[model samples]
Target chain A: MMNPISRVAKSLVLLFMFFTLHATAQKITPYLQTTSQVLELPSRVLNETRTIYIHYPKADSTNPNKTYPVLYLMDGESHFEMLSQYTDYLSRWDVNVIPQMIIVGIVNTKRTRDLTPTESIINYFGQPDTSRVSWMKPSGGNERFLQFIREELKPYVDSHYKTQPYNILAGHSFGGLASVYCLLTHPEMFQAYIAVSPSFWWDREYILKLADQKLKKGGSLNKTLFFSDASEGVSDSSTFHTNLLKFDAMLKAKTVIGLRFEYNYYPKETHMTEPMPAFYDALRFIYKAPYK
Target chain B: MMNPISRVAKSLVLLFMFFTLHATAQKITPYLQTTSQVLELPSRVLNETRTIYIHYPKADSTNPNKTYPVLYLMDGESHFEMLSQYTDYLSRWDVNVIPQMIIVGIVNTKRTRDLTPTESIINYFGQPDTSRVSWMKPSGGNERFLQFIREELKPYVDSHYKTQPYNILAGHSFGGLASVYCLLTHPEMFQAYIAVSPSFWWDREYILKLADQKLKKGGSLNKTLFFSDASEGVSDSSTFHTNLLKFDAMLKAKTVIGLRFEYNYYPKETHMTEPMPAFYDALRFIYKAPYK
Candidate 1:
């Protein structure tokens, strides 16, 4: 092995060479840079500023006027980078499985407040936690959150980015429940919806009841939906998996025209581990076609 | 829809509020940033400069002295960001499927010259392409390339990064063939190997013959290997998938002690799209364990 001193000298020489070469030759940036921008959007409805993580596709000079569909994802801090990376790779020139998408990751300040649709003291278990410092203390601001996205966030994104009219809304857990709620309540907002392990046990299945009431039989629901549940129900005593099955059954019962949907069950994966594979499957489902 | 002028005004107001809040409150950078560095290393073995993409996991203040396993991926330009993103997400606090790894993506300077093991004029078809400017003109320099990795590249990485002794070698197509060659020739270099849709039809299945000759029956070959093939053989009328099956059968017959291996075949996936799912499966296989 080379000694530490020589290594240091070598590094110095390499650095000098790099600078000189950079000055003379093309800049030595990576072949492609995944530019992730952090933006703070002022939410008029929620009365607070929301942080958004926007990941744009690499610029195509040949097709400068090309626009892309947007994937607006909830829980940005947790899964934004993953989706961004996935979108970039799957939509690459070599691997043209999916469309190139602009990923808008909505970072969360108040998870329960924004994700939950109702203010309830009930926890994951069938017990009530009425403590002031409970994690679920501030719940049920999802409607306002939706209003923020519709009235403020959507308008901002539309004006700023070269976006096609098609959009997708994706979420997991409570965020997943919020996605289902959005699909039932505001289906026109997005062309497709992905809900990975949605918490259907929220408020004793409030969303399920709403879905039952809202979705008319033989209704013209022209949209695509991808939802999933993992090993949560099998491990925990809760009926998380059962709830998803019920939702699937409800959909099968209703004859909504133009409603394309796929429900997946991953018994081997946990709620957290499910998203990696689940999200990939969802993309494949949404963009299923013959290889070009 | 909001008018352009009003949207521009809204953006200005948001930008002003962002700067003001940024100054007063805590800086709004995300909690975790998957930083990727582009490195240019002058190589003496190959007599050429090489570009390397290194992606480090988010630093942990709780464990400042944490060292990570390194995953050295071939074809860095194609899949560096994807692997970086996968590593970040799978090793997250909530997901926790795999250990956090330092990804060293070896970008290609000359694709065919470095990735192929043998100097041959045999093309993908059963015929020879002897044209002067054929893509296969610069046939093989893989041994010299391996020397660069073993002597120059590995030393540089070990000295520069905080790395554990454990390493993984991953690749696809020609890169995948290179990975298998490394595993067969230099098994001690990496603890694990992932070959996604390997181009096993290279040079009239030279690697297969080598495997048969070199790998003694019931030899003590200790390593973790994951290899797969998609629908390439069926489409191209080539023996890519058949070659993998033969290799698998050879391994099974050999009964190499301490050789942990898994073979996956994705009939639905093309050679290009196979890596996305196959890599994920390979990770799961290598890191298979009960949830902590």
Candidate 2:
């Protein structure tokens, strides 16, 4: 014999509890996971310990046998997350094109020191800054930087992670210049190379000369290269665009066998903005055909 | 008085201990001082708990008086990381365009139900789909779905986080349809709308018809909109391209004041691959003039 009002109140409480618990239980859980590691490298050239940021897809316990290709990117502090996200999404279980690769972001200690070749006074404006404590001080150590990668870094990464031998070296601006340098000097280091708006004017275009010297006429240099430039450092005079045109022509003139290359010019995009589209296009171009 | 071998062994032991301590020290150091929380919403209509991934930029404790714009993204599960990474990188003190904003990724539960305006039997191939448990079975609930967003989701987000009323709603394909629907039905919900590769063929082009009905001729609909499409479900005979062309024409025909709009067509890109480039273009187009 319960009163009608009391019975209604009891029912209301029960209903409230049910809704609350239901809402609490309905929480949507995320399935995405990530793993990261920091490696400290003693750079004898710079006499400093450089920390590299390495981010890889979280190993799926269910499929332990899967191995991944590696992408070595310069300007790690700048574009690590971009590459990481792109790699993760493109290599998703559903949308698999590129393999789930390890991203080795070489964080800059002295950007100019590692990314530039030939210690010179040339700036983006093609004018020399003779000022002391200029940002360009202690420049042109890309050769040693490449050595660090070829000798020290690559071995360390291969040993620690499940990796495929196929590797890609990517860079932007001075990092772009470094990527090209690697391609010309140490062609065996990477299977593919991506240079987004390389400062080809670096050291009076030292790498361009190297390319001309290294690549013989109609020689076979089996590799994939993607180079792009945005509406950056492009003036009324022949500076940015001209340099890229020269590089493009050099590759074409060489008629280098097994050299699959593409040059993209984004007049609408700024230097900073070019990486977004360029990186996407680069990945697509690199993996355009199945690994032959 | 130690022998040479004993000295070498002692040095090796010291080196191992030093390395261990160094590794421990590195492990304790955090890269980003930011933390994020995941939000879950259950929809009785969709029969699923929709997971909305969120990334709120770490509040600068030094500057207590700060607020941010919100970028509401569709297809949350697919492109959340891309947007998150883009926002984080672009808004760094180095490359600031848009203010550091909170990212709200609206994951799909009933994608077809929430995105399509009408229930139609037409399939992608222009054939009637009569199969049981078809993906298009529970369709044409976008209006109610929008109500859920405007009433339930937005309120919850505003109440919990510090947000400015200026919001951007972004989507792709079916999500794109929902975005355009929101713009037409609830214009006050967001300041900007982005529709990438919208499935214009949905419900025999119901949205195009709705747009004609809702958008008053020569009216002022002060809002920004970006719409784009790739080669999706398009062959020699399909009307996907024609449908988009008609929609674009309708948009242009309306002399809506303060209506900023951009239409892009990527012949090289496919529907599945268009999101990467389309999203980038959308962001750049939306933020272009104001930034310049």
Candidate 3:
């Protein structure tokens, strides 16, 4: 039994409150489960400005002082988000297959220089490319790149983040060559290695020769490795498929007791599409056991 | 050539600028490719506040008026980011496998209530649970849930966002059951459906019987579907595996035309882990051709 004026005023007030609440509740915020940081790292080793993307595991309330294993990824600009998403999703409380690990994506400043093991004028077709501006020019700075990673990037990440001793180095294509090369040349740098279609064609199959040399060195190496190839191996028509096979066979002939490895071949998938599956499988293979 | 005091002053200035640049550049921000909005929509159909997470594709400068297919994903809290990341990665300028999609994630308030098609006391082992405080007490409100999506949610999305005519419904586990259920009952709602390990054992195989009835109706269904099962199928001690087989066979026996479908079986993976690969495969299968 309110009067008309009173009822009207009450309705207007109610409407105003509802709209205010509605507007506040409708605040559009980011729906991200985890956060990542981008650092513009100055590198004297490569003489260039390097971009680093780091995705740390979300702080666990159960263990505040928990330290995580570090996964150093190459081709950050291409696959950083994909790896970060996988790590976050797979290491979830309910979906706990892989342990929580910090992902440090090292973006390439110079692709050919940092990834290839040796310098050469040779192209993919077993012919020398004497072009004025070859894509493979200014190459063979991988040793210096690794020095930068080991001395500068590793130190920076270790001092800043909650990191465990276990380290994994992962990459695709030329970056894959860098990963496998690091395993042979500097095995102490990483506990595990993932090479998704390592380009062995560089410098007249330098990686295959390097692997052979490392095997001949006869040092008992304790490491885990996962390498893969895609349809491009055959379509390239330059012994790309056979090179991968030879690499696999060379690893299998390893008398080195502590080396555990798996090689996957994606016949249906192309070079680019292969990473999508290869990365997932590599993670599964590497993190079969949760790291403490 | 300069005095000691002047040199010291110059060094200090340089150091100060370096520190300022370092501090500003080190300002950690979110590394998200796209932002998502969480809208608390008041649904009159369900008489509750429905939480919706919508991930719209980044604005394309080339084609500002581009409308995207909306993927209505159940269990937004679990797999929304995965779908969003996959869509972003696959639709990149260089690695263009799939089209950019709008992911409308429908998180559940009452998972059991909203997902199941009918109310029943029958459990997974075909046994009745008469407990007073049962998990399935307030069950079988899926029709109401669909009503909410259709009457309230879909209209809200269509009006507010840049959505095309094509719609996709995707879910896993009980959510998977809902996706399939929606297809059989309301086939016109979405052009594509993805059900990862659907629970065919719900309420004494009601979904199986429903499929039979739908098949009997004999109307042509022009749609794309991708369904899969994992290790839990055989381990459940029920007809989960066989039911999935029956569903696949029934679909294959289709006198009705235009239903393009693929059924994948992952024997090595668990139910929880299956979604990782299943969703990726589903996306690849549905978008075999880039959507216009």
Chain B TM-score for the candidates in order: 0.89, 0.85, 0.90
Worst 10 residues of 3 chain B by lDDT: B21-30
Better of 1 and 2 by TM-score: 1
Candidate 2 lDDT for residue B274: 76
Second chain of candidate 3: TM-score? 0.90
Q: Rate the local accuracy (lDDT) of all candidates.
A: 0.87, 0.82, 0.88
Number of the predicted model whose DockQ against the real structure is largest: 3
Q: Which is superior by DockQ, 1 or 2? A: 2
Write the candidate numbers in order of decreasing TM-score: 3, 1, 2
Task: For residues B164-275, write the lDDT of model 2, one tens digit per residue.
Answer: 7889998988899889989999999999999998877777777888899999889999999999988764644567777888888888988788889999998777676778
lDDT of 3: 0.88
Candidate 2: true contacts recovered, fraction:
0.26
What does candidate 1's lDDT look like per residue over B49-117, in tens digits?
Answer: 888998888898899999999999999988887788788888987788898889999999899999999
**What is the DockQ score, from 0 to 1, of model 1?**
0.28
Each model's DockQ?
0.28, 0.34, 0.48
Error of 3 at B102 (Å): 0.8
Candidate 3, RMSD to the unseen true structure: 4.9
TM-score of chain A of 3: 0.90
lDDT of model 3 at position A22: 61
Root-mean-square deviation of Cα positions for candidate 1 versus the true structure, in angstroms:
7.5
